[model samples]
Target: MDRKQHIAIFTTASLPWMTGTAVNPLFRAAYLAKNGERKITLVIPWLSLKDQKLVYPNNTTFGSPSEQESYIRQWLDQRIAFISGFTIRFYPGKFAVDKRSILPVGDISEIILDEEADIAVLEEPEHLTWFHHGKRWKTKFRLVIGIIHTNYLEYDYPRSIVCNVHGVNTKFLEIGKKRFEQQHGSNQAFTKGDYYIGKMIWSKGYGELLKLLHDHQKELVGLEVDLYGNGEDSDQVKEAASKLKLTVRVHPGRDHADPLFHDYKVFLNPSTTDVVCTTTAEALAMGKIVVCANHPSKRLLQAVPTTGTEKLSSKKFASVSLNLWKTIEDTSAYVHHLALGFEATRRVFGAIPGSLQPDEEQRKELGLTS
Candidate 1:
């Protein structure tokens, strides 16, 4: 029998971080490992928040690195206990406050070599200085795939793939829906209001959202906005929202699969920096109309019928948001289709191609030949 192909995924962060880079790759790893066709090693940078004395936005507290690793292992084992070929490996690293990331230190190339990975997937390769320097890991793996998760422009690698949005785990969405229905009844209705769930940072367009509310106070007289997230700028966001005439409330972040997420009629996101805004996809999958800023990275979202993209300005943002709210129709019918849209876009991860042999065009793309 052919041996299982060993695939090592090097990611910037893991469970305790609660960011897209951490969560997305994790789900991909779990889903890919479920079938047990290949051996998967999810490599994450490790550092204790207590040791670093750093305040993480998600408000999760870990006593030590071992505790964090144990928690993650337990979580994964509980969910994927049947999968024997899966593993999670932690490497020593430090958190970068400015970047809000745990960058892997030491020799990562040697680490990947030690794993004997037939394929190495670098999630957000640009964030890893050691991997994106070119040609270093090129000859080592049968194929090196760089999955760009950010908007960084300078970093590019052989066999690079740009996935505008990653796939959502339909199982979680189904569970949330079922729980909601069980508690509220099948005909339960959503509250009439706007909602936003993501990092509470300023770059998420909190300034734009507040300005839109302030400038259009008269037109949006009865509009209510509920924002849920945790970030270093949480207090600042709350202070800004307090001055607005509209009813805006800031709350701590919740799990992406929380049923509360489905209790809103509209979802608003004005951030353009996200290369793959996972929450936006989740909102749409839950049948909520999403109003976000127009950007090249949001191309996939723009294609969804329930999503609207507008220029990043208070005026246009308010106009599109109110227009979508006013013209809103029943969205329940679009859930399945929207989920399929995201799943189809991210099918590459569902069943990764086994063959490492690249065709002439792919060979050129991988720089295998002149």
Candidate 2:
């Protein structure tokens, strides 16, 4: 095992962003703070009101952007235990998790050099380009790694160690296991139903899920569907549900640890662009059947194969197979698939190369710093 060491996390968004892509890095920082012996510093962007309203409108109830920003920073500070190394400053240029934008790497390199960090954790290749392949300035840190939290891997993979955040065990998963499971046990309440907990966006495939429900209205007689999270497609989802006359419950905010998981029979994950949906894994961990859309992530696909056209038959079940819905309707099949999927995900968690020891030769082999 590697000895305890200092880690500096440079993220593309502020701590308050609720999306898994934005919050995964925070989970990394928190895990380091709680479980490891290390000095951790988190540097994140402070978004403007327009950006805040665009991403998370329901969570930010403050009167102004300044208030929201202050509240969020204070909230995170309390959680991470703020100190001299912790930083929250606005990026000099625009920054988005999915979009291609260059960070102010010159300013960021200065911070790394000033802090004398042993490891610098970049969010993605867009971030690593600033330091690893620098022209004007280069980061002299012992190790620099990229945290690939999404599906954007078109650029040439970097030479240094690269990691996907969802595949790793995080503070969110640690606490969720202890908290949500205790509140909601293995005892199943509802005999048959469906639920989806994520942003209400087209990319999330909620609109398609609603369309499936609409198309299979007669097939879904006794089953109920619950939708959580808010986004641009919130109104559209509700409207579709209304048109279909499906008994769909819409929750305003995210709720992962509630009794909702135990009460539901199937967890719907119809996301189209998600690399690795942690919430889906969390639901599976809680012992619920998951029917998700097919994706290309080898880590996820290893467990849930892309083949198999068998669809379960039940009036309480609905699946749009033509639309690429990977339906898991059998109780035994669900358990087997969830176990396989979760096991694959857990294996990835064990593979994260974080804070290699000063004397480790593997770091040298990978051209990473000790």
Candidate lDDT values, in order: 0.66, 0.55
- Model 2 poorest ten-residue lDDT run: 350-359
**What TM-score against the true fold does each predicted structure earn?**
0.71, 0.62
Clashing pairs in 1: none
Q: In model 1, how many backbone clashes occur?
A: 0
Residue 93, candidate 2: C-alpha displacement in angstroms: 5.8
TM-score of 2: 0.62
| Global CA lDDT computed for model 1 | 0.66
- Top-TM-score candidate index: 1
Please provide, for model 1 over 166-232, each residue's C-alpha lDDT reduced to its tens digit, 9 standing for 90 to 100.
7866754664465466547766557567988877888778889889889999999888999988777
lDDT of 2 by residue, 1-370 (tens): 3655767787765534456645667666666666546777766544334445665556563344346447755655554433433333333223343433223322344445444567778765354342221221223577767666556543234233323345443333554455455558874335557888886777778778888887888988866787887777788777777776668888775546555455666788887555667777776666566897666532355533233356568534544542334333344334533432343442343311221121233223223333
Residue 165's lDDT within candidate 2 is 47
lDDT of 2 at 83: 41
